[model samples]
Structure formats: structure tokens, C-alpha cells
Target: MGEVRVVAVDVGSVRTGSFAWAAVDVPAGGPGLCGYGSDPASAVASAAEALAAGRRAVLALEAPMSVPVPQEWEQLGKGRAGEGNRAWSASAGAGALGTGLVQGAWMLSELGRAVPGLTVTTQAGRWTGGDARLLLVEAFVSGAGKPVATVLGQHAADAEAAARAVADRLGGEAGTDVVCAPHRAFNLLAAQAMWAGLEIGADELETDVLVVRARPVST
Candidate 1:
């Protein structure tokens, strides 16, 4: 009912740069970036601890709560390229889905160890349909020509991008709308620049906090 710190964690199956963290204060205004972590689960815990500041936190994961069945995997992978024959194509799809869904349970459990009573949901909750991932990708790419840097690693932006998505949904009920971090939001928010074409050349976020309130809450 009150403010909840919203953090989005983009889980990775790999051993390094496996996690990115982004967060925002709910019903108020402010965002914090956690960058990337080789041990992302631990990094997420640390990020939550710092941003929570003794408040409840909501975590949004870019993972499926349940793994797909073989048939389900086939369905998910249906219509992709290189599906030679119908049967082979189905098998290929299944393998791809299985690979992508691997160890998701471990990641979820790791997160549970960190934040108790932390609300969790899949990234699908944030979008309208099939192109959801692209939309988020667009949000990240849209920041081109803005001043942004990754203090953690290359994957950090994805985590923040995920965080913004989570905040937009959870904060929606609180009449809080989400928007992209301005070029300045990333300025000094990270270490020296590793990513190009996004830095706007500022050291800090000014009044234009990259998030702007666009409309009144409909009653």
C-alpha cells in the first residue's frame, strides 16, 4: 500500500556477468544501479540490501517460474529457422528451449535466500505480447546518444532495463509511472565508459531525472 523498493534482476545461466541489478523507490522517485556481478545472485542480495534501506522490496525476474515441458518447449521454439523437417524442427525447438530454461530453479532459489517475502514474477507481466523482449531491448537501445556507463560490466544495462519494467508495473497501482533514465542518469552512475554511443557527457542527473510524469491517475 505504501512505498516498496522495486528491483529487477536479470538472471544469467553462465558463471560470469550472470546478473544485473536496477532499482527505484516506490510511490516516490529515485533509481539505483547495481551494475553486473559474476555472482549475480549475491550481487542482487547486496543491491537489495543497499536500496531497500529498511523497507520492503519487490523483485521482478526475467525467468519462467516453471520450466517448459518437452512439448511445451517445441511449441515455444516452433517456427524458428533451421527446422529442416517437421520432426527435426520440433526436436531442435525442444533443445533450444531446454537450454535456455536451464537452472532457472537454482537462480530462483538463490534469490529466495536473499530477500524474504520479496514479491517475484516473470518479465512477461510487464508487456503486452510476443515483442515484449524487443520493447525492453528498444528501451535500452533507445538510450543511444545519452550519457550512460556500466560500473559492473557489459550486461548491467539489461538489469536496469528490467528494473524499470518492474517499477512501471508495481508502481502503476501507486500512481507511479516509469520511464527511461535520462542520459545524465547513467553519467557518473558507472565507472569509465565501456559502452559507446550512449554517453550524454554529464556527471549527474539533473531535474530531468529521465522519468517524467505524463498523465494524471485515472480514478
Candidate 2:
């Protein structure tokens, strides 16, 4: 049996999203979209299940980013506004949002720490939303070290090309042999919200949003 190669992803808020891949004997292909969800924990857990079903496998994840927030706001009820109360409220809201973002990042870090044998990485930019198939392809190609001709135009076509390139790099059956779990529904909505300019706050958001990889021990 050979090692299975797999790629796991954690979609970013403003950025494209995070992704990771590995090779295991279970399957030797570029990678497939195992599971998509808001939190990294669930995503990783699902990916791990996929890997176990196969054989030896490699794992990857997205790295977390840190954004700053005001300490006074984080404390609790601290500040009040006068004439510009609306502006103050907006500022406070932003700060609260920033704090949540920071917390999510921290949670992501913690998830990674708790899980062993997981490889983690981050994507730098925003990926325009569309069909999941296209995004999967784009992620594969991007991970395989192929040049993405143009991210702006022909987004779907470019992503497909990248997917093919990644398949070539993996040296396995391009699309057929590779098995992928469906993207989790919550993740789909979250990804859409992110694309729509929604800020993923910490306190209100779930922890699963940050998870990127997981591998379950064989029974």
C-alpha cells in the first residue's frame, strides 16, 4: 500500500481561504475536497476520516492571522459616548469584531496544537465565489506549484486548468480515482457570507470555522 495524498482547506474571511495536502497509500492523487465547514475542527475531523478510509496520508491546514482590538472594549462595559455616540458605537462594534477575529485565530491555533500529524498553511488573497467544483480545482492547482495564468479573468477556467496541473503533479488518476467528501453545508453558507463582505466575529462565531485538518486512528 502506498501513502495517500490529501489536501484540506479552511476558507478565510477576507482572503481566498486556507489549504493543506498530503499523500497516503489510500489514494495517490492531487487531492479532493473532503469536507467544507465553518470551523477548522470539523473540516479536519472529516478529512481525517477520509484519510483513514484510504491508507497512509499527508495532512495540511490553513494558518491563522492576528488582528488587533482595543483593550478597554474587550474588558466589558467601559466607555461611553457624547454627541458622537453613533460614531462611538460603530467604533466599539468594529473593535468587538476585531476581538472576535483575534479569538477565532487563537482557536484555530489551539485546534492545530491539539491535533498531531497535521500540516497547516494559509492562502494570501480573496477568491471570488462561485461553484464549489471550480474552487476545488483552483485549490488543487495552487497547491501543486503550477502557475495560475490569471485569477481575475476566466476564474472557472483558470481553476480547472490548475486542477489539471495539480493532477499531473500527483501522477495519479486525475479525477476518477480521487474520492472527495461533499462540502459541509454550514461551510458553504459561511464561505458565501465571507464573499459577501461579512466580518467573522469571534464571540458569535463557532469554533469549527478555524479547523483545517484531522486524521482519525484506524479501528
Candidate 3:
């Protein structure tokens, strides 16, 4: 039988990153990190090119949100006592505290509008337990230093620290293995793209590029 390939995307307002892999004629192992990219157009283009090179492919994207919106904010609030409290207050002040999930859903809807055939999923939507930030923090810690934990406070520090952490994590065998095989490869690739942008001093608002590989699959 021909190979079955898969593609995953992590989309953002300005930049979008994707990853793809083939699982044909191979063991029941993880998916490969075929490629990544910045914009949806480029990411889709790259994936097509990869499909041209490989056997067959399927696409999986992170869902926008499955859980309640306020719950997600509460999740982000943990360990961020001050900012969390502030965000909570702002939400209360604006009477929009519980709309985070709705916002995420809306964003996902808008993104889907922009990219047809794109699917949306969230960390919770994937049934992947634990906070997304924690995963990011763990990745950063494994790759970089034991600097001050940014969850307490410090946006720039957190960004730098996370970037270094992601770089370090991706620098070794384990890191590569995770990105190549994990189900949530899109999140990892997105984290890497964010780290790269940080390294290049890209503005927070500026879109960044991520290169991904595409593989072919039987329909």
C-alpha cells in the first residue's frame, strides 16, 4: 500500500506554521517533522510541494477551543497571580471575563474563513492534559537555563526565556524526536517559530516564517 502522510498547522493572525510527515512502509512510529512555514499560503504551498515529493498526506490542525472560555483564562491565570488578577479584573470590569473561549472560537472561525479546509483544535481540544504554558515552560527549561520563571511576571523575560528554552529543547535528540513524532507537532512547530522570531528580534506584531515539508498520501 502507499504511504499515509499527515499535516498539522498552528495558525496565527499574522504568521502561520505547519508540519507534515509520512507513515507508510514504516513501523507504527510517530509522524516525521516534514516542514514548517510562516503564512497559511506559504504553509499550504510547502505542504503541496512535500506531497509532490512523498506518497500521501492528511492534515490535522489544532482546534480553536473546546472547553469553556473563562476556564481557559483561569488556566492562563494560574502561576500568573498579578497579571491573572489584572486580566480577571479587566474582564470583570468589561463584563467579559468568561468570553475568552468564545473569543478563541471566534478567532478560529475567522481563521477558517481565511484558510479553507483548515481544521481548528486547542490544547484542551486534543485531550492533551496539562496547561499549554507548562508544556512550553518545560520545553524551555529542558533546552535553556534555569533562569527566573516568567510565569510570576516579566513579558520580555518570558519571551526571551521561552525562546532560549525552545531552541535548547530543539537542539538535542529528544527535542527532534518529539517534534518528529508527537501528535501535537503543530504546537511544537509554532513554539519553534515563535522562538526563531524572538531570536531575530522580530516585533511581536510582525509575522514570521516557518518552513514545513509536505508528503503525498492515497485518497
Candidate 4:
């Protein structure tokens, strides 16, 4: 098992200063490289750069990677089972999710285009290091955000926060048991990537979605 790098992108509009990303190379320690960008290309490039030989890269997107459709179709207005206080379709979340849909897909497509051998997996447990692989995750930075001092601004701080959350998970932290459930929306982001020609490892109904939650801060 070699080093694992985690890159988290705080998804926003396509306009300048809207999109921001942070990357942390585990074992090397703290936040490695982070910046704000106008597009997802820069973030994609960062992930590609992190995918070195004998290393694994985890790409965390602060967006709704999967929409859990309730058993009662009319109950679509509710959130996922474990999403207690923070619902994906809430005011702010809804906006971010809608905007991130295309950007996330584009980022995945670009990653596939950039790295031919990029083995993308939604399961974090399968992220055993040693070989070059890419793990995709949905970053949950909601619920008053992570307990971290703001840096640069909210966007950059959020990016770093998400990165730290993912890093902690890879370091053996307990994970959220949120299920993406079997639906047309399962693996939503990856499905778009597949439609764009990326070779997906099989569209399973009940697959794992790495929902990396930020560390709790004690009051």
C-alpha cells in the first residue's frame, strides 16, 4: 500500500471564482495544493497529477452524486435516509447539486480522457493502496460546515474541509452508512461519464457511494 491523495472540489458555477479545489497527499501530511478556479478542468488536472505510479487518488466532489429516490415516488421532496438535517434538495443544496451535475460529469469524463488506466470506484473500502486507482466520493460539508478556521474564503475553506474529511476516512475513520438505493439515479455522476464514453465497471443497483462526512468539532 503506497500513498493516497485526496482531492476535494467545492462545486459551484462555471464562472470565475465560483469553483475551488483542494488536494492533500496523505503521508506527506497537511493540505498539499489548493486553489479556486472558474472551471472543473483545473481540478481534473490536479486529480490527474495526483494519479502517479503506485499511488491512489480520491476525488471528492461537494455535490449530490446520487439522488436517493424514496419508495413513495411522491415523497421525492424528502432527503436521503441518513441525511438528517441536511437534505440534498434543500435551497442551497439543490442549487449546488443542479449546477454540479454537468460539472461533475464533465470532470469525470475529463479524468477518463486524461488517464486511460484510471480505475474509478465509488467504494472507499476498495481503495486499498499499492496500485494506481481513482476513487470517487460525495463530500458532505453541510450541517454548519466542518469545524475548521476559515482560510482564503468560504469556498477554499470548504474545499480544504472536504479534503480533510476524506483524508480522515482513508485513515480509518468511521464512514456514513447512507445508501444510494437502486434507482435510475444510482451512480448518477458515473452514469453520465459512461454516456460520454468512459468505461464504467458495471452499473450495479445497490452499489457503494463514498459519502465522506466532515469531522465533528466539539463545542
- Cα lDDT tens digits, model 3, 1-219, are 133333333322341112111111111442333444333454445434434554332333322111112234434322211122223234332222233223223333433344344322122112122112111111111122324433323322332333332322222221111111111122322333233231111221121112111112124
The lDDT of each candidate is: 0.36, 0.30, 0.27, 0.71
Q: After superposition, how far is residue 83 of candidate 2 from its true place, in Å?
A: 49
lDDT of 2 at 128: 18
Model 2, span 114-190: residue lDDT tens = 44433322111111111110111112222223234344333333223433333343353323211111211122223
Which 10 successive residues of model 3 have the least lDDT summed? 133-142
Between 1 and 4, whose lDDT is larger?
Answer: 4
Looking at model 1, the pairs that clash are 146-198, 146-200, 147-199, 147-200
The parts of candidate 3 lying over 4 Å away from their true place are 15-30, 65-219
TM-score on alpha carbons, each prediction: 0.42, 0.27, 0.26, 0.84
For residues 1-219, could you state the per-residue lDDT of candidate 1 as single tens digits? 345555554545465545455565556664444333445455456545743464555544443212212343435423312112422125533443343234333433454455443332122233222211111111121232112446665446565655655556544443222222221111111111112112222322221112212122234
Which stretches of candidate 2 lie above 4 Å from their native place?
1-5, 14-33, 50-168, 172-219
Please identify which of the two predictions, 1 or 3, would achieve the higher lDDT against the true structure.
1
Cα displacement (angstroms), candidate 4, residue 29, comes to: 5.8
Model 2 has an lDDT value of 0.30
The candidate that wins on lDDT is 4
True-structure Cα RMSD, model 1: 16.4
| Structure candidate 4, residue pairs in collision | none
